[model samples]
Target: MHRRHFLLGGAAVMLLPVPAVADAAPRATLYKNPQCSCCEGYADYLRRNGFAVEVKPTNDLAEISRKAGVPEDLEGCHTTFIGRYVIDGHVPIDVVRKLLAEKPAIAGITLPGMPAGSPGMVGDKTEKFVIYAVTKDGKAPSVYATV
Candidate 1:
């Protein structure tokens, strides 16, 4: 075959779909106080879901949250940034991925406090909690996910 034809054939073969990769997901950065263990668990959850994570240890979590635009009422143990959205507390990785993929109009999602049975707060005596979607202006949050 001519060189140009052979190159074209090779390019076509390269374009053909290959087997789906087992792991191909963008990473996210997590910021939380250094003393919180639950926040570490939440980070682990993110790791299992194919997200490479950078855990930032901070003592003044409030300051960090304030700068990141996380609402006071929605404050949790952890704060994560994926693209433009800030995720707070023990929010499920799946939910984070959903928000990232959908690119909703809301500012972010929060699980609030250290609710038991949440991604980081997994235990037998779990307390039910609600996740809120906080807007940019720090307004009242609409229920995003409930558990």
Candidate 2:
């Protein structure tokens, strides 16, 4: 329950109880270069999709990605930590939710570089995007999804 006040006149007021709302937003932490604006856009996109995102600006994004088990060649513009998995690039929230729901035994998933019309980046999509799942065992990434 919520408390609220209503003013009927200059000298009159009424108290009322308003219903409370429950908005459960999934949480994620994103790390990106300090000067990258596209990452911010991605964070906003996540927020719009009911995700509670905490974006951190850092200059050592490459080092962070490397430590997170993402290969250098398949790195994205930003890295996000959702639950127990790492998400690279401008991946859509639906895919992220799928990963969380399925709970795969991989390090995380990556969409590679800043693809056009992926999530935050600009421009129309020229081709279908292949999302790769990276593992901690140093094996080559395999296709996870296409969108």
Per-model C-alpha lDDT, please?
0.80, 0.89
Q: After superposition, how far is residue 8 of candidate 1 from its true place, in Å?
A: 6.6
**Where is model 2 more than 4 Å wrong at Cα?**
1-23
Q: Tell me the tens digit of each residue's lDDT in model 2 across 13-53.
A: 33444444423667899999998999999999998888889
Backbone clash tally (model 1): 0
Clashes of each: 0, 0
Distance from true location, Cα of 78 in model 1, Å: 1.1
Judge candidate 1 at residue 67 and give its lDDT: 70
Residue 23 displacement in candidate 1 (angstroms): 9.6
Candidates in order, TM-scores: namely 0.80, 0.83
The residue pairs that clash in candidate 2, if any, are: none
- Predicted candidate 1 versus true structure: per-residue lDDT over 37-81, tens digit per residue: 888998988888787788999887887666766777669998888
